[model samples]
Target: MTQTPPEDAPTDAQSTFSGTREVDPRYALDEASLGVWLTANVEGYAGPLTVRQFKGGQSNPTYELSTPGRTYVLRRKPPGTLLPSAHAVDREFTVISALHAQGYPVAKPWALCTDDGVIGSMFYVMDKVEGRVLWDLKLPGMAPAERRAVYNAQVDTLAALHRFDPAAIGLGDYGKPGNYFERQVGRWTKQYRASEIDPIPAMDRLIDFLPATLPPEGPTRIVHGDFRLDNMILAPDQAQVRAVLDWELSTLGDPLADFSYLLIAWAIPGSLRNGLAGADLKALGIPSVEEVVARYSEKTGAPAPSNLDWLFAYNLFRLAAICQGIAGRVRDGTAASPQAKSMAAQVPALAEGAWSFAKKAGA
Candidate 1:
């Protein structure tokens, strides 16, 4: 179902500079202004040139810069106000840089600037990556032969991330690893409370049941934080995932939490919140909850999806809370999307799914 933007999304002004983009006012950058910022931060830059706001982000505002001999992607926090953690461009850059050493798929980093004087906030630059975003494809429109292959490929790439050890990649201090389940419940519950304009009863219940009912152990790994079809760029005409983008919210935590988010990203069979751009949940052989549980079981040798219902419910609640945050931005006049607004409206319905998934799975 269409839901709010994912959690761990950076939505503040200071966060805007780190090379991601979200809802923000259109601001034109003059040559001199651009030159000042570029020279101050980026090295070996001859002059400041044209900068265009990059689309395709729901958190920070991203831009592309054209220099005399090269191109770069610039991500920065949103221009207006933001939350406490939103201004973490330095942290985002540092974490991603560290993770690069460890077998994780990521873009090559160029520079990070925390000085606010250059561009009104912090920012970073990386080599531009090109590939298919792979988000809006509908299963019904796909050739039948390609459906199962694509779906299976998605799962395996995710499994690859879980295969990496955080410390092996020099991410030992990137983020703390313990207390995954309780932290998730607490973090999302707080987001729900802060972003709530009205009370959603199912959310409260899902929040309460999650920690108490679910098991308490999982291995720590570098969670892509926003892993989904759209976030992964694939090779041209190949099913293999190339680089996984958007590690801003990534941290050392339980891989299953990220896995559950991926599960929810797929269209649930016969559900009203089916994928947003017409990706029929039924056509893609979108793995059933049981199948997903089994696959992860085989791969990780972890516990079977025992609290399937709890995970399903909690995931939706977390999604709804995230949507509410974006909806708040819309109210503030920063974001513009009919679908985003519509998704925010669906929080209650998504919460309903949360409740149903919880009960159906005997959670």
Candidate 2:
């Protein structure tokens, strides 16, 4: 049984997650100090800089830095305690710097500040990509044809990403190559346990079941752990992707894991996490799951997974674990967003959904 969004879930995702807001007081930084650093570190930077925080990004606190010359975006590790190996802005900078050189749709890398004294945490800045960041999966105002084009662009971009040879691009050692699923299961399970607030039997059951059912390892590629509609910037007047944002969870791993995670939008409901479970694809002009898979196959020449149930289960559990980490942050006074509590509240339902998929896969 797929989980539906809660009644209190924000119905208008575009309104909720789109655009920028005044910096949250908790995540505020010293604008004068940052401007000074940018002048010294980032080439071609001049100030009279004004900063406003972006409303999106749950893991890293991002800001829009406006200057007389150009605009830049900053991503930083959240202040105070953090989960191990989480919020690697340096890694984000490295990957984007590498990919941008290859003409990938990612922001141009500017500079990375490792000295915590400048901002109380490590941070990096990049070109502020100019485009639309659509939050609503239904794409409310888009024409049906435009919606179809956007969906096609989305699949095309992902396939292009998967086709990149990490070694050829100087990312050969980005992450461990083989035993991707087994390692991921262990990693998330450990993180979940570290962040556990209350006992979730479903998560525990998954921890036990997933390792035993590990699928055959596939060729490793760069995996964007949270690739989804919201993570992309689209051209203002076109269906093309201008840039892909938020590289905090990217690493060398199974490309299928990345694709399967994107497929979750078709499985989960909009109310829960802005998913498309009950969406009318024909009317909306959005591609069906089969159409999406077929298009990906056409682009990548890889066969669709014969069984995605296990993959869905693993992805849901991974998401639940991530949200649980947020819950732990809320408890420890390190949560970055005002919506962290609401996100934390979904952990139980996500765990249950994962368990349902596990059962479907004969857990």
Give the alpha-carbon lDDT of every model: 0.64, 0.88
Off by over 4 Å in 2: 1-7, 270-273
RMSD of 2: 2.4
Task: List ranges where model 1 is wrong by over 4 Å.
Answer: 1-24, 27-31, 43-48, 137-142, 266-303, 336-339, 361-363
Residue-level lDDT tens digits of model 2 in 1-363? 011233355767677777789998888998878988999999999989989988777779999999999999999998998889989999999999999999999999999999999988999999999999887788988899999999899999999999999999999999997999999999999899999999989999999999999988898999988888889999999999999888888999999999998898899875554678887889999999999999998999999986699999999999998988888988998877778787889899899999999999999
Clash counts for all predictions? 23, 2
lDDT at residue 210 of model 2 (Cα atoms) = 96
What is the alpha-carbon lDDT of model 2 when measured against the actual structure?
A: 0.88
Best-matching candidate per TM-score: 2
- Model 2 pairs whose backbones collide: 5-271, 5-272
